[model samples]
Target: MKRRRVPALLLDAAAIVAALLDAWVHVDPDDRAAAACALLAAISLTLRRRLPLLTYVLALPAAFVTDAVFATLAALYTLSSLTRRRSLLVVCAAAFVTGDTASWSWPGPEFADLTDSGNLITVTYSLATAAAPVFLGQLVQARRELTVRIAEISKARESERQLLSDSAQAQERARLAREMHDVISHQVSLIAVRAGALQIGNRDPETKEAAATIRRLGVQTLDELRHMVGVLRASGSDPVELTPQPSLTDLPRLVDSSGIEVELHTDLPADLPAAVQRAVYRTVQEALTNVRKHAPGATATIGVHHTGGTLRTTVTNTARTRPALVLPGAHYGLIGLRQRAELLGGTLSAAATPDGGFSLRLELPVQDPG
Candidate 1:
């Protein structure tokens, strides 16, 4: 639950009304000096938020000249709530006590009557009255500070929990990498070696070509596996890359190797940031991969162009010419691509065209070269 805050204007208005009421009870308008001091004190409450000390000083004259003490007490409370200077508060409280107890005479207040027993009781009561607002103000200040400290503690605990969760995830990834390296890699290696042997032994042109393609793809898979293993082995504390990440320069090779009819066109600047280039490349790669999985025997077009400070990339594919194979997929590729684009201060959008085609568009802001 949250607390509703009072409007400053309303609070100031209330303080002014309270001060004027106190004046009505204790001050006589016939005495111009007392009336003027009380009115000045009432008006000074508006400045309490910005200049608490000044407001307190301005309001003190009313406590000395007349019995109207509401404005002076309000100013004191405001000052105590905002400032941390204990000694200054003590002095101001003492000044308020003295002003409330002394008698107004000639040029200044007379304290001769304070020596009497009755006057001493009056002084003690004045001291108690002054301490009331100070204690209340200090309590409010402490509560405000405690709220801020609690918020900071909550944020710290949340960060700690996230770090622990990430550590557990990293451990799982490492275990999976070990399994792939020790088992899957061995099987793939055997396949590649046998494929190579068949390509060499067979004289038939079609068989040799198929064996060669298998060997090539197996070797590429092995390279990617090695990279993935390295990434898994390295934790967040120490980042290590076994192979360079793909970027715009690799887009052409990626399109060619995708095994789909893709027409690539790019008109990007040569000096784009590496992060921006990688984001564009990944967005295109994921779009093309989705096309391959969902739209079999489809022709695709990829267009990447830079205009002003914006980089735009679009991937579109025609409707499938053949039925899509029932392949197992988590369907997280586009979600991951959209998150990546957002991380780079960019956007990713995908939709089905009116012609029964799929289209993906990515737009990113580029940093100025100069």
Candidate 2:
């Protein structure tokens, strides 16, 4: 029901001029009748946008009486703009032609040549006037449809961009979680082993004091682990944040906490990259955790060697005096260890030894020290 004010005004002006021209060109001298028809046609033009069908119906009778070409064209324009039904348009056109013919025949007796070549000219002019409005209306409809299609395309593209961004964010979050698992699991295993040993060993005063110290250290390590997890959880828009992550240099303290006598043999170069060091450290930690869980009372040996551009680590533990405890089958620690090694373009393997023991091996690319 949107009213087109500009088209209405133009139609009104055209109607008025048509009415004046009809009256002036005719042989009959009826100025008052001509002026009345012109005024009525102008008023009818204002209602065209709102009630196009009614305007066309009203215009036929008025045009027949006044022979106002502009009023008929204005009504035709309204029909085209408001309705898309072709049959209705054809019906309206036929009615207009019939009305024009009837109006020409009305002043027949006095002017025999009134419906002659001059009448044909009027018919042609009236059809052209009517058709002009219909063409403009079709052009407007086409423009509107094009605008709608473009808007739909723009919205689809925006949705696709947002989907890609969300997918990338999810991938990054998973990678960070894997790294955190590798770091925390290794640290927690050492604390568990040391705490278990301190509860079972010798009762001399100095020995008791050292055991209590180990127990306290185990408790402190657990607290720090909890704090680290909390910091990771409160990352977004929060003041508390996780400190820089540990890499490989912290491995000595981790190994000491296991309370296992470890013999280290190394030919690894000092210039190894931080990433390679971290992977090697994690592999050793997982191997030692397995030893503490599955091979109690066992002695462990850790060896690091470099040949060509590759650095290798191997951890081996002998059988225990007490029956070996079967560790709970959790893949998170091992899976995380393997992922860390692979991230640095390395490989890792674990195997049972022939003498009721276990061994873990890891190999990584090395940087040579001068």
Candidate 3:
């Protein structure tokens, strides 16, 4: 309301100026008191925003006495938009009736029978004068309220979408952690056990030393990998699925379900270790998720290369082709992937493309010591 004061003041000033001009140009010299009364009515406009009904009550009598239509209109509009008290409306009506009769009292007959043509015209004019501005102001107020409600609805919907996105990401991360724990950790422990047995049984010094080194490296890696996976497992998520987790081979299914146009190329070995395969699948999954969430209708391209001693995975998407619903993100997708890649002795990179889309790249060692 305080912020509204300045604009309201300007509008009231304009109304008062118009009333002053009408009085100065048209009123007779002997009727200068009428002009004075109109100026007084204009001065009362300061209460319009804070005390709109009071402003109206003050304005109507001064308007009747001074012939200041502008002051009356401004007061009526302010009252209609700012308040809706039936008692106040009744008071204003009483004021109007008294003023209307007082104006005609000098030149016309008293209100007797009250059905004469002159009285009828006076009544109709007064009713029209009271109703028009108030009705218009009420219409404007209703439309403004409607607009505010629509904006609130839009903001509320966006917040709900953000919450859903965060929940889904957390669930996916937890699932990944469960898979690494149940599958990769178990396999690595078996390798360590086998190495320990070899070190104990082997007779050759060279063979025994190699087996000892393998056992030590395997144990160290299992410790680090387990720590990272444990952090994910600690998250609140749905119960783990017993079915085998997704891998690189599930890329087609992910793409088909995404509803975004995608092109893919790969030169990966079919027998990639479960950990590497899972990492590659997640990298692609995250990239696609981002595209659908932020760049709807954008085309995507995914590439995998297993060359030399490393496997490199890349997913890139074009800029959004059309307007789409964008939900707020937790911003942890790429950070989590980067940490996972580092744990696997690899690297992850993501950057915006020239077309305003984004690209994610991850490179993992083809083989790890443990």
Best prediction by TM-score? 1
What is candidate 1's lDDT per residue for 92-179, written digit by digit as tens?
Answer: 9999988888777888768837669998899999999999999999999999999999999999999999999999989998898999
* Model 3 Cα shift for residue 12 (angstroms): 3.7
Q: Per-candidate TM vs. native? A: 0.62, 0.48, 0.56
Scored against the true structure, residue 204 in model 1 reaches a CA lDDT of: 100
Off by over 4 Å in 1: 1-6, 112-117, 202-210, 230-370
Candidate 3 backbone clash number: 0
Superposition TM-score, candidate 2 onto the true structure: 0.48
Worst ten in a row by lDDT for model 1: 1-10
| lDDT, candidate 3, 103-214, per-residue tens | 5446763552457888777777877776777677778788889899999999999999988997897798788988888998999999999999999999999788778767
* Alpha-carbon runs more than 4 Å astray in model 2: 1-202, 205-210, 213-217, 237-244, 326-329
Where in model 3 is the C-alpha error above 4 Å?
A: 1-9, 101-114, 234-370
Local distance difference test scores for all models? 0.90, 0.70, 0.77
In candidate 1, how many Å is residue 352 off? Answer: 23
lDDT of 1 at 179: 98
Per lDDT, what order, best first? 1, 3, 2
Question: Who is ahead in TM-score, 1 or 2?
Answer: 1
Cα lDDT of candidate 3 equals 0.77
Q: For residue 96, what is the lDDT in candidate 1? A: 90
Model 2, C-alpha of 118: deviation from truth (Å): 11
